[model samples]
Target: MIPLRAGTVTEVAVLGAHCDDIAIGMGATLLTLARARPGLRVRALVLSGAGTERAEEERRALDAFCPGAELDLTILDLPDGRAPAHWDRIKNALAAFRAGARPDLVFAPQRGDAHQDHRVLAELVPTEFRDHLVLGFEILKWEADTPAPTVFHPLTPELAAEKAQLLLKHYPSQAHRDWFDEQAFTGLTRMRGVQCHAAHAEAFVLDKAVIDFGGS
Candidate 1:
C-alpha cells in the first residue's frame, strides 16, 4: 500500500446516527489524532439520544477519546430507528453543521450501512460537505453489511487496547449489547490490521478523493 497522508489536519468533524456510533466506528483514530495534534478541533454531531443518559455517555466518551482537543458536540432527540422519516430535519441540521466548520477531515457512516439511520446521514453528509474529504467509518453489528474499505488507519497495539478499554469504560449503557465487547472491538481491529500490515487498525471507505502529487 502506498500510504496517503492527510497532512496537518487541524480540524475534524465526526457524525453519527446514535450516541455510541462514533466511538464504535472511529474511537481509535480520534485518540490517535487528538494525541498527535494537541488542541485539534473536533466537531461531533449525533442525530439521536439527546436529553437522555445515552447523550451523557456520549459526551463523556468523546472527551476521553479526544484528549487534548477542542471538542464541540451536538446531540439531537430524533427517535432512534426512524431517521428516514425525518429527512428534512436531519438535512437541515447537517447543513447548519456544514456552515459552521470547514474541517480538514470528516468521519461519517458509509452509504451502504445496514442501519437505516446511519445510511440516511451517510447519504446527506456529502450533499452539504460537498468539497471536503469524507471518510466513511463502519459500525459492526449483527447485520452483514461491512464494506471493503478503501483506506486504513493503522493503530499501535497500545492504542488499540486503550480504545477497547475506553469504549467499555465510557459507555456503560452500551455494555448490554452482545456485540459491544472487548474481544469484538479488538478482533475487528486486528483483522483490519492484518489487511494493512499492522498490529491493529481502523478502516474507512473513501468514496471520493482529490489527490495532489506534489512535484515539478
Candidate 2:
C-alpha cells in the first residue's frame, strides 16, 4: 500500500485505451485541474484500436470537453482489443512518454474495472511510471466492487450534468446504449457524492503522492 498526500500539481498525463474512457473516468478532475492552475498542459493519449473508430471519435470529444486546453494528444494506432497481444508496442508507448516528458500528475483506470482494456491499462501504468502521483478514476459497472477514493472533489451539478451530456451527445454510438443515459450518469455521480458526503463529486483512487513535507 502507498501513502498519499497532496501538493502543488501542474501537468497532467491522461492515458486511456478507448475514446470515452478519460471523459467518463476523470473528466471533472481534469476540468478542476485546468481551472485551478493556469497554464497547465494536459497530454491525453489513447492506445486506440479498431473497435469503433476510437482514434477519431475521442479527438473531437476531448476538444469539446476541455475547450481551453488545446489537447496535446497522441493517438496510438494499435489494434483495439489487442493491447495485451502487442507487448512491445505498449512498452514503446510508455518508454516514449518517459523519454519525452514527465508529467507531475498521472491519471488512469483502476485495476478493479470489469473491462479488460481498463485492467490492462491499470497494470501497464504503474510498471512505467513509478514515482509520479497517480490517480485512478472509476467507471460504473456491476463489477465495480470496493470503490475507494481518498481524494475527492465536488463537481457542480451543472458541470456534472454537462459532462453526461458531453458523453452522451458527443459520442452518438455510446448514447444508443442505456448505460450512457442521463439517469445512469446522474446516479453514479450521486452514489460517489454520497460516499464523500458531498452534493456531487468525482473520486480518485490516490497513490504515491510525491509531496515535500519540509517547509519550502
Q: Which candidate should be chosen as best, given TM-score against the real structure? A: 1
| Ten residues in sequence with the least summed lDDT for candidate 1 | 207-216
Provide the lowest-lDDT 10-residue window in model 2. 1-10
Write model 2 residue lDDT over 100-212, tens digit each, in one string.
66688888887677677777887888888788777888876445454677777777888788778887767776766657777777777777778767767888787666556
What TM-scores do the predictions have? 0.98, 0.87
Q: Compared to the true structure, candidate 1 yields what TM-score? A: 0.98
| Segments of candidate 2 deviating more than 4 angstroms | 1-7, 50-52, 141-146, 210-212
CA lDDT, every model vs. true structure: 0.95, 0.75
Off by over 4 Å in 1: none
Number of clashing pairs per prediction, in order: 0, 1
The residue-by-residue lDDT of candidate 1 on 69-158, one tens digit each, is 999999999999999999999999999998898799999999999999999999999999889999999998889998999899999989
